[model samples]
Target chain A: MTVVTDGQERAGDVRLGRVGRGVRVAVALVGIGLLINGSVRASDDAWPFGPMSQYAMSVPDDASITYTRISAQTDAGTTVDVPLNIEGAGVARAEIEARTGEIVKDPSLLQQVADGWAKKHPDKPKYVKLELIRDTTQLVKGRVVGPPTPAVLATWEVRR
Target chain B: MSARTVATRAANWFTPAIAFARIAWLRTVLYLFVIVDMHAFVRDTRLKGEHPGLYQPLLLARMFDLPKPTVFNTTALYVVLIAACLVGASNYFPRIAGWIVAPAFTWWVLIGMSDGKVDHDHLALVIALWVLPTVKAGRRGRASYNDQARSESAGWVIRCVQICVIATYFLSAIAKLRSAGWALTWPGSAVLTWAIVRRPHPVGEWLLHHPWMLHVMQWVGITAEFLSPVILWLKGRWQLFGALFFLGFHAANTAILLIHFLPTVVCWLAFAPMERIVPWFQRRRASDSDAGEAEDQAEHGREAKEQAGA
Candidate 1:
């Protein structure tokens, strides 16, 4: 094996051919260009090359912080908060939040959440009704003013 | 300077020779992390398949006309990904394994992030997967962890990964600026308070009491992200410090927001000379074996003396 201790070209040192180098440079340029373009103009739909806009928007001090919660009335005649997590409902809160517009447009979209919960918890009491409740907390100077007010945005009666 | 001299300098900058062994080590780490990621962070990809009507394909997925995730297809993807990642991590058939992993994981992530929100944390990681396969591990392959031989191909790939990692940060700062109406409104705003209140974790709940500390943290975060490119230029201890600083940043985010940017964090290995780890371990092992041999020889000599006396 050819070993070179000095900072010089050696037989053992691997090098890319001219074509390989050209291809890599071109790829790098294009990738970087797309990233810049995505950040400047594209939305989340242009993902893998989209805006790094997580927490990019700032919330005003006096604005209300809204959270979409899933509350279900079970066959056991009790209402409980269905946690928007993979284990709880087989869906993330963010996923539900992302499609809030659609859910608001069509209340029937919530059947999926009920179906998911049923699939995950086969033995538990089936949900009779699933409500998308928005809990809005009023903030003053970055501090919570009072308890959040829960408003039901949409409701879906589960089909048994 | 002459145009020829400038062009040569630019070419040299793009292809600085880096140890091939670093690529071998990074490849193993990245591939293995894919398994951890699928099981934990993006576990919802499979669940999303069950509700295909909710599936909103990203631009890339839509452009390629990739099939929508189904129960069968997603399960198949999960099995295939796990198998491919294992083989790639093992350093066997790296090119083929890497090629499979690159597109598969990208598709997996596309499906996972197709909901309204797409995480910027994955930018570097996804790009790394694409570029890593371009370079081969030479004849030694998996056994080249201590190859010591430097290559321009390895350097080029490493550079590409590093750029993307920085872009995830630098562009994020720009995104913050753009979203805030080209003003520095982000650092001074109550975004953290809103997030903490929304999530309601213990540490974050405690942080809710102290508003000033959160404001300071926002300023520090944006400043670091804006200046993230300096890490690439930093050498030796400074570069290490820069990397560790970002890691600490992620740790704080986890502690407060419970958000783990592990994908981006794992790609930070690009900044390190990972190949040195193998040699370091080998040296320790050599010393350990030497000590063991000396002990054995001493025990044998003592036994020989005892027999002579007897």
Candidate 2:
């Protein structure tokens, strides 16, 4: 009977030891998590934000962005403001494909063009306003390479 | 049974209390009160001026979709979610509130995530919605401490939510290491300056121009996140200081950014034991075990009286 009691006592000690080990493991994991967190906190462009940086930089999906307004000084010299749904960022590098004066129906492809410029000048402006006129679409087909300039705007005939 | 058996049973009974303390420390203090509230401020500050009308629902909808929502079709869904949140805050039919509010909030977050610029605040709401359904916040478990049984079994979900909150900091800290510039500039006025130039609060704007203020904020932010484990776990004056620092941080954020979630703020009130404030409120209210025994004895005494009368 004493032998059986002694074995039981040893088994209980082992179980207690295992429980202690588990708690230690938990504390250690939490510590590692905190250290990692502290290091990552030091970075500027963090995760959730980094993943969506492109989209935030992308033009507003809906036809109209609240803060930005699109006003066109028409050929008649009359300025009419119609909100162009500004989807992406970088005003200088953005290109718009217009079909006979109206913006293109599919804006998804614009993202690809914007992304290409973003790769070259990651920090510089990528927002380019494209005024699509009937004949102008052919003149500026691929990526617009640099920032929006008087020469580029004049070449594209983007008056507004 | 021997005295050892009796002592063991008593110790076993105290397990839940220890667990409760752990949960309260993490859930109420760090995640719910500090980290989550800070994210709310970030989102709120971002959506200012002309952006409120368009951004509020748009951001919420984007939470539902990480990129590209199917369509921003459901206005009714938001209203229901708001209503459920209001009710859940009141702790009425907590289980039901948890179920409805969690899904509705999740739906809104899915919509918010659809946009690339997702606010971290929605993650907190998601975790809260998931856990609120299982907690014994309402009267459901008021009859006995066995209510912990129902809660302990749902441990996986609780841990997941905890993990999510912890990861936000972990990931953020890791990002800090990637660039030397972030270390030198971070925990400084640049964050505040960016806010001031864009959307300046009276106090924030005033403080931004003060070169010393930015330095103070930067150090505080770094030190706070770095010492989070210690500040949150050590119970006493240190815990209170931690809570206050957290409050000040979020309050500053709110002043600068207009996001408001009063429920979350109230939940933080759990940090300081309300027992002292109300004095005898919880005790006078009586523990479930006491109430249960009282009811049982009352029933027995009434039965005896009835039999004697008969």
Top model number, TM-score: 1
Runs in model 1 lying further than 4 Å from the true structure = A1-11, B139-142, B288-310
List the DockQ of the predictions in order.
0.47, 0.06
lDDT of 1 by residue, A68-126 (tens): 89999999999999978889988888888989999999988898888889999999998
Model 1: lDDT to the true structure: 0.83
**TM-scores vs. true structure, each candidate:** 0.92, 0.47
Cα error of candidate 1 at position A124, Å: 1.5
Candidate 1 C-alpha RMSD relative to the actual structure: 7.9
Q: For candidate 2, lDDT tens digit of each residue in A20-92?
A: 4345335435644543553444211232222111111211112111111233333445544322222222121
TM-score of 1: 0.92
Query: What are the candidates' interface root-mean-square deviations?
Result: 10.8, 17.2
Stretches of candidate 2 off by over 4 Å are A1-160, B1-73, B79-93, B136-138, B141-173, B179-184, B256-310
lDDT of 2 by residue, B1-310 (tens): 6776664433222111211222332332322332233244332222122122222234333344432322333445545655665554444454675687666555544433322244444343355456546444413322221111122312323334434443433344434434434443354324444433334358765664463665576566556645554542345566677667767766766775443334334444434432132213333444444787556545433322221100
Instruction: Compute the DockQ of candidate 1.
Output: 0.47
